[model samples]
Target chain A: MTDRRGTDERLAAWLDGAMNPADAAAFEAEMAGNPALAEQAAAWRANDRQIADALAPLATEPIDPEWLAQMGLAESTAVAPAMPPAANDNPAWWQKRWVPVGGALAAGLALVLLVVGRPPEDPQDGGLSLALDSTPALQQAQLDDGRMIEPVLTARAADGRWCREYRIGDVAGLACREPQGWKVEAEVEAAPATKPDEIQLAGGTDNTGIAAANARLGTADPLGAADEAALIASKWGDR
Target chain B: MADPGPDSQAMREEIIAVLPRLRRFCRGLTGHAENGDDLMQSTVERALGRAELFEAGTRVDAWMFRIARNLHIDAIRSVGRRGTQVDIDEIAETRGEDGRETVENRSDLAAAQRALQALPEEQRSAFLLVVVEGLSYREAAEVLEVPVGTIMSRLARARARIDAVVGRSQGTGND
Candidate 1:
């Protein structure tokens, strides 16, 4: 094979877009005349696509605490309030990276405390308790009698067995994957995030932060503290 | 640049936008699902931490990729005397030409990935930054702290070497 006039690497370089418009134009002309170089470029791009496809399949997956801990982004003592961002803000690719990955990663933490057991005798430590999986990247989760209770998400209501969401605020919502997908077994308004076990829906205060009741749970209204134990038995199917 | 806060935010945005592409680059570099995510995580962490270091309106993706390349290099060097070997079956396990699980003429893909890993760091870096990452010659030179001309020649040699290796796999490359 006759060696091309320019280096093989130069063509590779051109593909990366390192050249000036003038140089790029020149390179294009060279490519126009050299079918071999064109073919090589095509193959390189295909390889790139294949490699990329193999990577980052979990963009939509919640940013787990495990990943954050690996990066050293330890949670800060002072949780900064969400003030308005800069005026000339242009949305960045990296920041938006979170959206396609799963726009609802941090689903609103809507919580409701249920005592399905005889109501806790002591009003103080006495109800279904909820807490976020302190694990980094854990959108939010709860602890129920030492069991990890998470919101369930699923393609079908019966499948709603395991997905969970957390409301960071009225507008912000986040969800996390449950091994069993998500379920809306029994209708329960998630309690306030701060008070996991003893949450009672505040009367008429904006319910924006409330976790919307899933239609499949089939309960007309929210569940009472009396029904917790039996609700956990159902299963949800994944799409 | 005392926190070109606007620029910082902009850089972050730009980097996030190219995440899929960055992910693609990481996959090519790592050749495995877990390794790719780890590499990407490392690169993204570095980019976020060093976002201030990036010049206003600079090539954010290129900057992030440089970090990825360095991490991969450091990993290879750390393994010392032993390099990461990609399974030829992985290429087939991945996608195929006819969309089948068959290796589909990819005896060369694994060989290519291994050959890429085996190159002298400089040559490999130059080659991948250009070929796999799609960086321009000058841009790659900038990222590697080398001259443009050096990048061009290195790339030339890299391709020739890869061609020889792949050709051997295909039993067609003129050695």
Candidate 2:
């Protein structure tokens, strides 16, 4: 007996016109002899049409106006319109162009000074300096919601982002701090009486909520006492 | 790191031109309009934030699609980490608009959407890119960053699943 499932794939390909002409002709001849294959092929075609019909309506759905504004295309005009001259008529367009250049130069100079003359108290001085300035060693970060969670581990990811694993009660989570704040990347609730290592290996399975979390947590270099202290002082550098 | 160059402007326009299609793709991906729109909004924010990374003169649609796919994966991973997959079948069945009650009997569209949502994420994305987006298998593979054979395999599986669904529904007089 032919594998109906295997034939289903070929029929799907034939329906998609993805099959080569020679193979298509052979399949057609075979289907002419096999009523079941033909019926299956017909069903698959009907299904494809129905899928197309059903999904075509989605193309007409209205987009949110806010999204348009966010893309800077609310005006629906050419992307870069010519900038009008500044209200002061003293500067010609050519001279007006120099203003942005001067501003950029001043900005670049300021950046250079800031980098070269960083204050000794600057939080980002060095890893050691940051450690020195950090709050006394504590493994907790107070979330904006005023809930406290223990930071189980802190490490610099390969991407150079500092990430942390935190535990709130029995649930553990991973988050990497961005310039804005702590962005929770993943979380898993531990199974009762499960060891941390076991949960780490088991991952984020629905029953245990452990396996997927483990996979996402992956391997990270653990921050030492001083680095963790620095991170805590930096508040994940959100400051 | 948004670039204010003319190329950036042009890319923004290109993205806007594709917004309807992008929204449709999101809706198809997420199984609910609200969730899809939220995902679309997030996609727009990330695209804008990383505009400088966009290569000039490249297909912005493909780039945006890649970004959207990555974000969707991240979101689902986050949800998985939370200990449950989104029950897309239920979400697709009960999803409604504008305070209207969800249809008592699921419509053909809902059924099709549920079927699409039922596929694994990899398969769903493959089907959408090839069938809905009208991309060639190679192009879809490029967008997905997978081998062409992988794209074909994924599309085959996706089609088989949808075909089985529609075929069953038809056999039962539901379609």
DockQ of 2: 0.17
Residues B1-175, candidate 2: write the lDDT tens digits.
3447777667666676566667767777777767777777888889878888888766777888888888888887766676545554233423422122223133866776767776778888888877777777777888899997677677767877777665566688862
* Model 1 residue A37 distance off true place after TM-score fit, in angstroms: 4.7
lDDT of 1 by residue, B74-127 (tens): 776555444344343233222222222222134444444445544455776676
lDDT (Cα) of model 2 = 0.58
Off by over 4 Å in 1: A1-7, A20-63, A74-239, B1-115, B118-120, B127-139, B159-175
- Per-residue alpha-carbon lDDT of model 1 for A1-239, expressed as tens digits? 23563646567557556666998898889888989878887765554454323332323233344544454432321124343322222111111222222223133323232211122122222111223212222233322111123322222123333323332322222232244222112222322233223222232222222223333232233223223222332221223
Candidate 2 interface CA RMSD, Å: 10.9
Specify the highest-TM-score model's number: 2
Model 2 CAPRI rating: incorrect
TM-score for all predictions?
A: 0.42, 0.53
Give the candidate number with the greatest DockQ.
Answer: 2
RMSD of each: 16.4, 25.8
